[model samples]
Target: MKLINLISPSANLAELTALASDDDLLLLRQDAVYLVYQAALPFPGKVLALESDINWRNITLPAHIRAITDAEWVTLSANASQNLLWS
Candidate 1:
């Protein structure tokens, strides 16, 4: 799956639009609304947003796209980092 990290205050929506493909994952957080609002792609893959983000009001996501928490992402990221480091 393709992962798009939306951690920038000024995320490029166009980048997501261009990167979106079947089975691509779009992770939204911080100021990601800048791009989430402009997402016109079908987003066949998952679109995950931070549960604590206030930007959710700016856009509408499909059922496939769900909200997650920063803690969850951190845990996942940490696990991935550990695996990479151990390897």
Candidate 2:
């Protein structure tokens, strides 16, 4: 599946949803971690956030979103069909 790295909260989510497929993975990092505050994510796929970023920002994430480490990020990128950066 595709692994999309979203780095900014200001990025167009509509564009993201359009680009992502149902089997894709969405990973929020940096300022994009703030997007977790939304009631629901538009993408119809798995969602993850950087664990360190979440801790640094002091934000609590919902159960649906998994918090991942830097090592896990590397693993996901290595396994994904494509790694996209949306900043």
Candidate 3:
């Protein structure tokens, strides 16, 4: 089953990423985007950043995480058998 992890904030991103499987995807939102910007987390699977969030903060999209639209986020979540939210 494909699992999507939503990383928000108020948690240890490194530890959370460590628990991820190679097949799991990471969706960086809110403050979690900072980690990717800093090149902190080398998640095994695909990494996506919420487009609106990044733009709202006036941050340039990092190479490590692709920006996804709200519609795409819905599709991604729908395709995943499991979704984990961390904040």
Candidate 4:
């Protein structure tokens, strides 16, 4: 599994699309948490946002996109075969 971390709002969409796979996990953190408001997403797989970031930004993610805690983020990172950053 791949862990794709998007740390900024200006992340390259083309690069993300080229790298993303169905088994990848997309993590929205920092300024990237604002991406949840977009109607279309670059990654088609599971999406997770930092709970703290989401709360800080007051973003309400769609049901399909989950808000994960710091521990959960660490667990995902530990379990993934590959880790990628979009920003």
Query: TM-score winner among the candidates?
Result: 2
Q: What range of 10 consecutive residues in model 4 has the weakest lDDT sum?
A: 36-45
Residue pairs of candidate 2 with colliding backbone atoms: none
lDDT of 1: 0.56
| Best lDDT among the predictions, by candidate number | 2
lDDT of 1 by residue, 43-85 (tens): 5556677777744555565565677777876765654422111
By TM-score rank, best first, the candidates go 2, 4, 3, 1
List candidate 3 segments past 4 Å from native: 1-10
RMSD of every candidate to native, in Å, equals: 6.3, 0.7, 2.0, 1.0
lDDT of 4: 0.89
Question: lDDT of candidate 2 vs native?
Answer: 0.96
Off by over 4 Å in 4: none
Q: Whose TM-score is higher: candidate 1's or candidate 4's?
A: 4
Using alpha carbons, what is the TM-score of model 4?
0.93
Each prediction's number of clashing residue pairs:
0, 0, 0, 0
* Candidate 2 C-alpha lDDT tens digits along 2-73: 999999999988999999999999999999999999999899889999999999999999999999999999
